[model samples]
Target: MPTPSAEAVLADSAGDAAFATTLAKGLVVLEAFEGAKLLGNMELSVRTGLPRPTVARLTHTLAELGYLTYDPRVAKYAVGARALRMLHPLLAGMPFRQLARPLMQDLAYSVRGTVSIGLLDGSSMVYVETARSGDVGPHTPDIGMPIPVVRTAMGRAAASMLPEAEAARLERQLEAADGAMWSGYRDLYRDGLRQCAERQFCTCFGDYMPAIHAIAAPLFRLRDRCFAINCGIPAFRLQQGQLEHEIGPRVRALAESIRVLVARPESAEPGSRGAKTQTR
Candidate 1:
């Protein structure tokens, strides 16, 4: 458990009013994403300490307005495109992709795989950028393609960035999913949190895409929100025992560099090549 500061304890004891609780908890559920990771309702329940039914109602309203997405395939939730639209004006003044590209390229080269940056959109992970060693594999997910939050490495790592209570609320979103999807959701949350606490990244094999092996790490903001970067390749082609041995450290390093760049906004110049154009 996190050791709460005196201020935090007092603030909780202040007890917000009913309408405040609804708005506060609703926004808290949305804040669960770091980049690509989506928090399901059950998971949201766990993270936010909000009731499962309350989360369901909140997410339902958000989804109806396209602020969050509900994916039946993975039975998870992600940020909606409309949410991204809201961030556009602020992101426009920043060179987010430029700051990320060099590190992503280095990670892809080191891992001999494809590397990508993703953002959370209501219940889906929107691929913002990518760098591949080459596209020789049978399956290569493209930029703008949305992946289910519960099934992908990027999604879990991103979700790990949320506050513990908020993370719990997002978990509540998972309770409504089908059995197979719920099982995967549970494993990803367990493993993703464990791996993130141990280091900066997590690894997965054939979870998101069959035959694809991947490693992902988080990019943190001053506000404590997290984003994600991932490196992946066809599992069949990787050298024996290379997955964790070589890829993990390299990806972690690249992720750290990106974190540094994000931390120092002055260096994030838009003129840099391979930079992502801010999305609206």
Candidate 2:
């Protein structure tokens, strides 16, 4: 089935069946990681909305190609070092991280909290780098920590731009989550993402952890692909309107600079195989 708008466009261009199928499935696999936790073969079947057998075959093929690695002991898969090795030239060629670091440090100093650079992984956000303010708070996220995407400003910022169906599926996962462990997010839940598409950022108060607030803005690679930057502020120091009034703009600026650097032909790295990059 095609939308009226899509039908008109396809009629005009003449439908290319092979192009459509391959491109669509490739994108499906890519999106499966947008906010997911670790996706095993079965989990990926659910996330990608693909059949189990298809997911298994794709995973097997990707693993053989050095893009994904299967850990038999854990029965899990993560992006292989080969995938990581693929990123080196891209990140190394361009100085996006280097340029952004100074700005992150400056923002951390001004805000008296912590600043971080992250990218979206499957259904979670992974922190690639972090700069903290003298360890002002407990529960500080380490460089490689992964956080639930539906629960963090960084993850929301990235996911907010996705299609509505994707966002809703993530919400279901959030709602289904149980235990006192996540009691903290209930209060901070905003129900729906607002102002994210327009602002290209998301702000959350005490969603990931009690007494911790954060502001996150998306960075871009080309024009629309979302990457992100975020600032973490402890509740103890948060003045009422600071996140929207001050921190938002600063994070957005850092994001913009990063976006510019990442777009350079040499700077954009191929994404990882199993694990996705942190979105924040």
Candidate 3:
């Protein structure tokens, strides 16, 4: 199956009357708040490619709906408490977090590294759960932190799970959207995806963050949603060979174990896989 271009997808969606353009634009206005403490209409317009008037209306609507808070004095908007209230339930509702945290903690302690589980959020991977070893150092994981999808092992692992055509389409879209940033690392990214397809895991060696290396594997759950788990260690502590040959398979096995745990019947045990743990 050939992947459709972004333009085609947008066009198709726009043509559908039930697609709710206004609602989509309102969501876009809310999303523009990511990583930003506050934004004015002009900045929001530029970020979302909506006209100033349209952005004003959208912001007004969002503010009315309690998704955003506006300050007339500063002429800026911030994420409202209502948004956090909505997010709290979603995070607390996921039963898998309770099931997965202990396993992640064990992995982190055994490998003396940071272990995390994440799901794709737009073009970034957002950490949903994390555990860190005592010696994890500066690379501590924070839940809800976003990592670029094209640059991290976890993101690559998720991408590798997509159909070949879809992956290619995504690569094309990324290149078109950010050619300068994408061009320098295109070959490396594609190679990582290929390796992930073959080995069921992906590796990053000081690619996204200097002096940090990680290995990641994809996990699938109900509703066809995909997630990724990664183990990250300082570059000085783990060499590239060790990351690939030693930690790669362990992380892959853990991911498979998590997948089985999620997909299995209620009576099944998640630890049946006997995932190997590293001792330092």
Name the candidate that leads on lDDT: 3
Model 3: per-residue lDDT, tens digit, 1-280? 1223233344458678777777777877877777899999999999877899999998998899888999988999999988878767767756787788888888889888999988764456888889998987667778877777778888777666555455666677667657876887777777777776677678888788887899997665333344678999988887549999999999888876775666532222111111121111
**Per-residue lDDT for 267 in model 3?**
22
The candidates, ranked best first by TM-score, are 3, 1, 2
Q: Residues 1-280, candidate 1, lDDT per residue (tens digit)?
A: 1122222233364554533556656676775554457778898877666689988998999999999999988888988899878766645544677778877777677666789877654345667778877653765656666666667777766666655665665555444324477675677655875676567677778787788988776654323334577788889778776877788778777776775666543123211111121111
- For model 1, what is the C-alpha lDDT against the true structure? 0.65
lDDT of each: 0.65, 0.61, 0.73
Better of 1 and 2 by lDDT: 1
Give TM-scores for every candidate, taking all chains together and pairing residue i with residue i.
0.59, 0.54, 0.79
Query: Candidate 2 residues 119-173, lDDT tens each?
Result: 5554556676677777658657665566776678877666554445544555554
Better of 2 and 3 by lDDT: 3
- For model 2, the superposed segments whose C-alpha errors exceed 4 Å read 1-95, 164-192, 221-226, 261-280
C-alpha lDDT of residue 110 in model 3 = 87
Best candidate according to TM-score? 3
Clashes of 2: 15
Model 2 poorest ten-residue lDDT run: 270-279
